[model samples]
Target: MSNPVLEIKNLHVWYRTYGGYSRVLDGVNLHVYKGEKVGLVGEAGCGKTTTMRSVLRILPEGQAHIPEGQILYHGNDILKMKPRELQQVRTRGISMIFQEPAAALNPVFTVGTQMFDVIKYSGLSKEESRKDNIKRLAIQAIKEVYIPDPERILNCYPNQLSGGMKQRICIAMAIVTARELLIADEPGTSLDVTIQDQVHRLLRGLVEKKEMSLIMITHSLGVARELTDRIYVMYAGNIVEVARTSDLFANPLHPYTLGLLSSVPKLTGGGVAEGIYGRIPDYLRPPGGCRFHPRCPRAVQRCREEKPLLRDLGDGHQVACFQV
Candidate 1:
């Protein structure tokens, strides 16, 4: 086993809200090994996006604060890196494909302009920083993602392209520079089913071809099952369960994980799909013990008093529930 490309240790992130402070991410522990595709699955507001943003130190400066935790990229702590070192990491080590392609792309700038700028600042050597070389690299990247007419597409503004095209452009930009890890935040959420499938396949192929570790944040368990090697089930701000994708689907331990698996719609015409009982708790005043205990069907008295830590069952299958 080689070293992890990225490792997050007990990350705690908070935001200063009008009501008080919201504990957005609480002691999140996650790691992505070299070339390993990991899935971060949770309902909305479960801090999935926040955890990834924290990895790049992109959280709102004044509003969000990391009281404790370490975001280690390779062996160094990202939380303590200087600006120049952090810039190096962002340009050469990691890249992110945002959830909304429209928001990620500058509507005003032509795709060529944006891509050229990215390549120029992508930690390229001085000899490779020429305008002609950058344009060539950009075109080649767009082509690799199966987007035809790269030159014409680059000349167009973001709004001129379709949703799927914009997403491919974003992917092209993310992979233009060689990176060790890529964080994809629901890249296909806004696309049609056909386009979503294409995008998913494109991502799978790209990760394999480039040998890049990936942290895919998604709401669709089906998508996670298809694209990830392992899955992390999150509840509120805690990771309730972690296991290989096959093992998780076959034998989920945590009650919350069970609920999530049960909620997935089946093709065999099972009655109506059942949803998890309760909504995620309020972050400002979250549950004291197990965050999911308020809705856990098998919760015990200890579940209401002690926060269970993730304990390994076997073969790296871990769950953070007292009953389990």
Candidate 2:
């Protein structure tokens, strides 16, 4: 295969809190090629958002920091870049969609004002860029996500729109830049089931149509299975499994992967879904070896003593467990 558009190697991000230091992302390694769609699935607080934040270099200032590892975009190390270079990357290279729309948007600014500002900063001329261009892109983007009355919605404030509408608008803003890599941090989180499905479809279409790479952070395996070419299973800031979508669903090697699959709710089943037994270990004082060992049903004595490197199992599939 050709080289990936973006590659993350051994990413480690942590925060300094009142109690002590908390490591949220530890040794996260993955790659995203042009036109590829990759889904990252994990339970809440499993470092899914942290991983995405690391890529954007927007980790909470002072509170969280990328202590180790390199983020490479098209073979260039993003971490090593200067400030101006990084600013260019934010505008022209990589873009992000936050999980919550209301939180992302400026309540004080009109939607048109913010959207036009982004467009103007992107190198478009003022004459070429007006309320019309803003409305055009905003409407087109919102409509692509299946939101109705795009023109009317564009004029409305974030508070005026429902949660689902706001989410769609946020998605439109992210894709409007037409950047090479789009990092979506749970774009469908607050929407209803029907709206969630529409958001998923819109995301898939955006990737296919633009040939843009996507790193979708979500908790839904169903969405992952439907939209991603590959899937990475994470737990407690560690990536436990990386594999092609079909191979992952068919033969999940890591205990965490199996546990996640078992937890997926069934539509017409007679029994309740089985949940993972233990909670994620505290990042401030994580386990000595594999982070998942405490909760892994298949964990053995060795699992408690040694952390495993990601081992290749052929066909780009890898697992990080001695037992696997």
Candidate 3:
């Protein structure tokens, strides 16, 4: 087996908000081998973004802290890294595409200038040595994302481009570093169906051509199915089920996973889609035992009294439900 490029072991993060600390990530364990594509799917505010942000150690320092666990990147503990070491890992080892593209880019700066700054951190030979070389790299990255007018976009500010165009630009900036791992937190959530398809296809091509690992975080199962080799279903800060994409779509073992699928509007099913009710429990005092018991249809007494451990069910499938 190939060694894992990234490993998150028993991660627990707490955010010290005015309302009290939110147990954002409760023992989130995940692994991604080199050149692999992985998906993390969950409802809104279920710790998907939190999980990805924790890996980079970019969480608000005063507001959030990892109480326990280790984030290992190529055998080095990221949490223990010095400031200089962390900077190297962020720019040279991993890249992240934030959920909102416009907000990520500087509104005042031209796209080309912003991109050149990112290229500078890439440690590429031309990043600071030659302006023309950096420009060439920027143009190439933009072209890789299929933008027809690279020059026009390079001169424009963030407000000048349409949502889709801005999203593509954001993607270009993230991949410009040619890092080992790319974490895309809902890359094109605001784009129309047509734009989304095109962007997603471009993303797959880039990852394959570069042989970089990817972590796709989204609420859409369709996107996950289209882009990832394996999928992990997250709920209320815990991963409920994990399996190969084909296996997950064919045989969903967790009740929560089934509920998510049922909620999707199937063209063949011919009925209104079902929706999961009940807000995610308050993190100040989360539900005891299985955090999902109150809403889990198949929940038993054990589920209410004791947390279910994630167990391997052979063939790379894993589930945390006692009923499974």
Q: Which one wins on TM-score?
A: 1
- Per-residue C-alpha lDDT of model 2 across residues 25-132, encoded as one tens digit per residue: 889998999989999999999999988887778878989877899999888888899988888888888888888888998888777667767766765567756767
Which regions in candidate 1 have their CA more than 4 angstroms from the true location?
none
Pitting candidate 2 against candidate 3, the one with the higher lDDT is 3
User: Candidate 2, which segments miss by more than 4 Å at Cα?
Assistant: 125-135
Model 3 root mean square deviation, Cα atoms: 1.3
How are the candidates ranked when ordered by TM-score, highest leading? 1, 3, 2
Clashing pairs in 2: none
TM-scores for all predictions: 0.99, 0.94, 0.97
Q: Give Cα-based local distance difference scores for all models.
A: 0.93, 0.85, 0.90
Global CA lDDT of candidate 2, please?
A: 0.85
Candidate 1 lDDT score at position 231: 97
Which candidate would rank higher by TM-score, 1 or 2? 1
What tens-digit string does per-residue lDDT give for candidate 1 at 1-324?
888889999999999999999998889999999999999999999999999999998998999989999999988999999999999999999999999999999999999999999999998999999989999999999999999899899899999999999999999999998999999999999999899999999999999999998999999999999999999988888998999999999998888888887887788877755688889899999998888888988988999999999999999999988797
